[model samples]
Structure formats: C-alpha cells, structure tokens
Target: MGILSDFFVATPEEALRYANRIEEPDEGDEIEELLDPVQYKRFTDLEITTLWAILEGSDWDVDRHALEYIEIGEDNEAWLNRFPDELTTLLARLEPESQAAVLEAWAGTEELACDPAELQPVVDDLQRLASEAAASEKSVYLWGCL
Candidate 1:
C-alpha cells in the first residue's frame, strides 16, 4: 500500500509531541484526546510536491519552502512533517472556484484518474483546515504512514 496521510492543524510543539502517537492504530482517538477538537482531513497518497505545485502554480523547489520534517519513525516507515506557512496561506486564500479548479487539475495528473466531483469534500476540508490554521496562527502538519 502507498502512503496514508492525514493533514492537521497544530502548533509546532503540539505536533512534535503527538507525532509518533498518531501512528498508533486507535483510529485517531488518542490524537483527538491529545489535541482536543483537532481539525484534520484524511487525504491518502497526496504528496507534498503535488501540493506545492498546485499552490505555487510552478515546479516545487525544496529550497523555497519544503515540508519540514519534525519526526521520523525508527523503522523509517512513518513520519510527521510541517507545512510551510506560505503554502498554508496560499491555500487558505483560494476562492471556492479556484479550489475546484485545483482539484480538477489534480485529477488530471493522478495515475488512477479521479472524478473531480468526488474530491469536493476533500477540497472543502483542506480549505477549512488551512483557514483555521491561519486564523489560529498554527501550522498544518502531515502525518504519513506507509
């Protein structure tokens, strides 16, 4: 199986504290308890490079703004990364139509073609998460497992 990813909003300290905890198989209950009302979305197989491209409308440059690795599993099968504030701001600022357009473009690029219609919920969740993160002065963190 490919990577299963969850995008969530949390402060740096909170994210690091719960980074490894999220990999547990408790269906995120522990995380919810720890973060209390955590805002997140399960978006599998969505790579940071893809998000960078979609948000910046250009090739991803690691030097410019990369996903900052906060923690890594001992076996190297999982990790937590923090999203750059700029990308979060960019996503938070996208209009509804622009979000839909991004989803349509993403569908076109995926190996297994997805219906943009089906991705509306994902778009909405991410938009809401980004906005909430921005408003609260927190960052978006990705928890990925393989």
Candidate 2:
C-alpha cells in the first residue's frame, strides 16, 4: 500500500496533542484518525515532495528528496507551530504566474503524474486551510501514514 497525506487546522495545543499521539500509534489511540479526521485521495511520496518544493520555490525533486513525509510534532515542534504562518506567507508571496508555472510543471512531469486541472482544487484547498488556520491563530499540522 502507498501513503496517504493530509493536514488539519487546530489550536497549537490540539496540534501538538495530535502530533504526539499519532507519532507513536497505540492500540487504543485514535490519534491518527484525528490528525487526518477525514478521508482524502492518497498521494504518493513523490507527489507530496513535489508539492512541498513548489510551495517553497525549491527544486521539485531535490529539495525534499530525503524527506519521507512532514511529520507533525516529533522533532519538528518549531515547524509544526509555525507552518501555518509560513505557508500563508509563501502562498501570498508567490506571483500568480509563478504559481501557474509550478502547477504546470508538476502536471506535465511523468514522475508526479498529476493532472493540472484535477490537482488545482487540491492546491486551492491547502491554501484555504492555511489561510483559515492563520486567521484563527491555529496551527496547521501535516501528517502522513502508510
């Protein structure tokens, strides 16, 4: 089976709680479910890494080549706390043309196998979540499971 990736908007406390719980899954723990909360289309690690690069304006294949996935609160506590703001800032700073270019590149790339039209909505949803999280003073937690 492949990996499924998703994020959620929650208070910093809630984000950390979910992160801590999900990092070490337990028999009674439903934390992973809480972190994701809802079902979503699974994206491969390659596709997710490409998305990360596009958002950060780095090389799509190289920047996150070493990353397995964006774990929530593990050793990345600082990032977990700040991602909402960082994503919002990055999203706001990217020029529209640049955004389109990134999407187009990912769509045409054979490795990612992303369809531009189909992928656009997912991108938009991420932006919306980031924006809402920032506006509400909540943190956005990124999580993935295989």
Can you tell me which runs of candidate 2 are displaced by over 4 Å? 19-39, 44-49, 60-84, 92-99, 109-111
lDDT of 1 at 84: 77
TM-score, candidate 2, is 0.58
lDDT of 1 by residue, 1-146 (tens): 56666677888877766665655657456665756533333343344557657767886555675677775558577677777787788878888767777887766665426787866666676677789899999987777767
Candidate 2: C-alpha lDDT = 0.57
Residue 119 error for model 1, in Å? Answer: 2.6
> What C-alpha lDDT does candidate 1 achieve relative to the native structure?
0.68
Clash statistics: count for each candidate: 0, 0
lDDT of 2 at 146: 57
Candidate 2 lDDT for residue 23: 50
Deviation (Å) of 121 in candidate 2: 1.8
